[model samples]
Target: MRAFLPLIALATPLALGACGDPAPTYIDQAWIRLSPNKDTPSAGYFVAHGGDAATRLRGVLTDYALKVEMHESMSEGSGKGAMMTMKPLDSVDIPAKSTVAFAPGGKHLMLWGVNDTAISRGKMTLTFLLANGDRLLVDAIIQKPGADAPAPKADEHKDH
Candidate 1:
């Protein structure tokens, strides 16, 4: 019985560790680049960290913006003939233990008619919907047009 007690103690910790929560899936470094033109939709970017299980980024929602859509930029041709094109994406897959970036020239969010309140606050809350039934709320820093804006890239706002 004493020997069995030692075995049970060792097994207890292993069982607890196995039952621990899975690695967390989350989003961070979120920001929005306001367009130089009010009529043009602004762009949003962020980085998503995958958890123990694979999932998909279904969409983003924000009360500050009238509309939000996920988009991807692609080059259709090669070399000098290369032309950039943008397409809306319904969902983006995120592999387990991986990172996905929504950057200036890659996947991004287009926001139209951002409310004045959010602009004044210089930040806004965004809700990220994941296929794994996770809703992550993150605050995105807002960058208004001018010198502090992100570096200008030809493909960044071609669609807007």
Candidate 2:
């Protein structure tokens, strides 16, 4: 066993190092679509990538907007008669090594009264609060409403 002592020491450190660190959660492709009507709330979308361990998205906060809330759209009925409804979400589950998208016609952020400073800068910083007590600050591109803007989908409405 004496001859194997040095080999064991070398292998032990490598094994411990491999198990020491886990991937961290992160957000990307964040953007917000401005509302033509000032009274209407603008919508925000992003993709959240889960870390090595599972966690929950508690909430999102931003200083640039007067209010920010997490919401999801759902269809109450089927076919042409289907009605789209939105409900506020307190938290969203994020599984390990998974990706959750906040896209149009699905989960999204509602922002009211976005400050002109952010609109002028064409970008804004949003804070993501996770259940693991990790607060991630991410920048989101701002898309202004204009002729060149992408047309809204049938399911996407201005009611929110």
Candidate 3:
């Protein structure tokens, strides 16, 4: 019985160590660039960190905006002669243990017909719909056109 007691203690720690909770997916540093012309669509950006499992960003929704879509801006040419083209994206994959950044001149959210009151408030709730049956709610900071929003920390941009 004494030998069995020692074995039980040895196994107890291993069992407890295996019971860790899975990391949850989340979003941070979310923001929307307000357009000077209300008629023009505004751009939104954020960083999404994947959980223990891989997932895709299927869509975005906000009650303050009439419509939202994911998009990517690509530069076709090289150097000073580069031309930018915007392409709509169906979804964005987030690999496990990685971070995806939606930044200026990169993958971003297109917000059309934003409510005037929401704009004046300087913030709004943005919901990110994930392919794996998870919805993340984040508050998006509103920035005036040409406002110098802070850049993402270097470490947070590991994967696009």
Candidate 4:
């Protein structure tokens, strides 16, 4: 009986590890930068993670803005003004256990014609449309570009 006890203990931990939960297929940490001026558009970013299955991000919808689009920054060619363009995207795939980061000068969500309420200060509910018709509702955290203060850093200590 004593010899069999050791094998049972080892097997218990192995079973637990094999029974771990599956990965998440969702978007989180969604944030948006407030425009420096009312005329300019804002950039939204977030992370997308799909578990063992693959998924794709089709587009986005938000009532606060006139238009929402998935955009990739372009190198301004020899134009009169800043070289940029807004090209329509079909979809973005989210592979299993991988993350997609949307940020400035990258693949990001462009929020145009934001209303007054969402301009200076407010929250906006943006739903990310998936290829599978799964809707992931995300909250866009609003803050003016270089507004009142800088973002607090992890190394920044309160005591200091």
Candidate 5:
């Protein structure tokens, strides 16, 4: 009974795994919330995945602003409410089987001159320039600061 149980456990997994499952497709169109500030530029965050091999981000650009720069946020000062300073990043790399997270109060995309229009319901296209010169376009949805907005549904995104 003991030997039979071990074989069942191992064989079950192997048999199920042999169903010819395709490799996972890389996740695209990831994002981060854009926190608001009176004196600072707006930031956009997201994750860039490198599915099978290493990837490097050379730059990012968007028509919504004069320039798009990669920046990292660092916490300084004392106490629990330590002030954070966002510093510019030269470049970013996503190693093989890895991802680069762009989140609030962390490494984010710095957008300058956000335009006069409201961000509550507008679409912005962010072009990510990779080290290999491959540019990926992701449509970023804008929302009000402090409002919790869930991710878009699958039906909203269909291959055209």
Candidate 6:
């Protein structure tokens, strides 16, 4: 019995480690910059962390905005100095155990026709549609033009 105790204790930890649950997929550090001109579209940013299985971000839905779409910002020199363009993204892949950032000057969300109430509240609810049929609900802080977003660390997106 005493000899078997050591083996059982060693096996117990290994068993738990092998059967441990994978980290859940989630969104973090989400925020939206409302366009000062209501006519123009606003921008949103966030970081999506994948879990054990890889997933793709299909789109974002928000009742506050008339339309929300995923977009990427790219800069190119078309013989006219530097020009920036926004391209609609059909989907973005998030690798397992990896993080995908929706940052400015990179991949981001374009929010159009945001409701006054939602803007006034200073927060908005965004539903992230994943390829795996999972919807992630996140509340994003809304920032007005010239309003300072909480000081973001380097690499985190912050609206200027």
Question: Which candidate comes out best when scored by lDDT?
Answer: 3
Clashes of 3: 0
Q: State the lDDT of candidate 4 residue by residue for 51-138, as single tens digits.
A: 6678899999998899888988777667577777666577888887777877666788888887777655556888988887789887
Global lDDT of model 2? 0.88
Window of ten residues with lowest summed lDDT in model 3: 151-160
TM-score of each: 0.84, 0.84, 0.84, 0.68, 0.66, 0.81
lDDT of 4: 0.76
Error of 1 at 83 (Å): 1.1
On residues 1-160, what C-alpha lDDT tens digit does candidate 1 reach at each position?
9989999999999999888788878887788999999999999998888888899999999999999999999999999999999999999999998889998789999999998999999999999999989899998889987535444345532321
TM-score of 4: 0.68
Worst 10 residues of 5 by lDDT: 21-30
User: How does each model score on lDDT?
Assistant: 0.89, 0.88, 0.91, 0.76, 0.68, 0.87
lDDT of 5 by residue, 4-112 (tens): 9988998998899888543321335444355477456666777676645576888888776666789998989889988988778889877776667787767888776
How should the candidates be ordered by lDDT, best one leading?
3, 1, 2, 6, 4, 5
Stretches > 4 Å off in candidate 6: 1-14, 78-80, 152-160
| Error of model 5, residue 18, in angstroms | 14
Judging by lDDT, tell me the better candidate of 1 and 6: 1
**lDDT value, residue 80 of candidate 6:** 70
lDDT string, candidate 6, 114-157, tens digits: 98898889899999999999999998989987676545557542
Clashes counted in candidate 1 amount to 0
- For candidate 4, the C-alpha RMSD (Å) to the true structure equals 6.0
Cα RMSD, model 2 = 7.3
